[model samples]
Target: MFNTPGNSKGDFLEQTKAAREERALEKRRDAAAALIQANVRGWLGRLKFSQTILNDIDEIIPDVLDDTDKLHYKPATEIYHQALKFLFVWKKERDKERFAKLCRYLVASLDSDCPNIVMLVYL
Candidate 1:
């Protein structure tokens, strides 16, 4: 029988495990892409707004806000301004008071961390 110095059954098993993990990861990526495509199609068929507006709002909100770990009052304030602009435009077509109430609720939720009285003035 032929044998190599470093080649052992354990090394073969480790290699096999790594390959299996890589295949599993690839499968998960494919599934996620399919799910995203289905969601987009469904939203397009049901919602009135164009894909562009939906994409813009999605991008704008997250881009304006800092990550959870780096969140601070300044970025939060900027996010609030951007959100207000979006909300105002949306409310013109929808319910204004309900939109205002939603804004109030959001401000109240952030009060504990931001504690800036100016936020209430906007409400």
Candidate 2:
């Protein structure tokens, strides 16, 4: 019978855990960047977003995700609402036509997807 050293086993486990966590974090970062890019690009092309504000939002998003407090359920909800308000106002003031259409579509879509709407509304 052979026995492995406890310290070595613990070290291996720690390294594995760290690697998994790093990979998960990278995946999250990539997803966040992609989402922000798509939203910003779409709104910009439609003239619904300002380049400067979009840049600011893009900068803040990663920091928001990185901060543990912002990543929590309640804080995240607050952040989401704040972001939504900012974007809504930005769009409405910049592009009234698109803003009205989007708001109408959103309301109708929300009515159709009640559960998601409820979650978002509560958030």
Candidate 3:
């Protein structure tokens, strides 16, 4: 009987095991990369959404704070929601001082039971 070159059973088994391990390691790396990508995308999406909200708040703050009625009786509920959104965005941005100052301004602006005061405390 003659043995074929490099065809020993032990060598073949070792090659098969190595191939399987390599494939498994590659799969694990791919999965980890994908998970990291997903987390980054989610974080970016949330940041963008918060930025949009913050911009909207900025545009309307002067008018609301000045009570110029530019929005002309723009329901208290809507104003309340805007205030809440502003606080959330500020909190996320770690600007607690600004938020606190804004709250004080809002309270001060309520010189005479401004409907905004009720709106602020409503919830």
lDDT of the candidates, in the order given: 0.56, 0.53, 0.66
Worst 10 residues of 3 by lDDT: 63-72
Report the error of model 2 at residue 103, Å: 27
lDDT score at residue 59, model 3, on the 0-100 scale: 59
Superposition-based RMSD of candidate 1 using all C-alpha atoms, in angstroms:
17.4
Model 3: CA > 4 A from native: 1-7, 63-73, 92-123
Q: State the lDDT at 52 in candidate 1.
A: 43
Task: Arrange candidates, best lDDT first.
Answer: 3, 1, 2
TM-score of each: 0.34, 0.37, 0.65
Per-residue alpha-carbon lDDT of candidate 1 for residues 66-119, written as tens digits (9 for 90 to 100)? 334343334456546656555544646554644554454455446445455234
Q: Which residue pairs clash in candidate 1?
A: none
Q: Candidates sorted by TM-score, descending order?
A: 3, 2, 1
How close to the true structure is residue 106 of candidate 3, measured as C-alpha lDDT? 54
Residue 47, candidate 2: C-alpha displacement in angstroms: 1.2
Clashes of each: 0, 0, 0
Tell me how far candidate 2 lies from the true structure as C-alpha RMSD in angstroms: 21.6
Candidate 3 global CA lDDT score: 0.66
Q: If both were scored by lDDT, which would come out higher, candidate 2 or candidate 3? A: 3
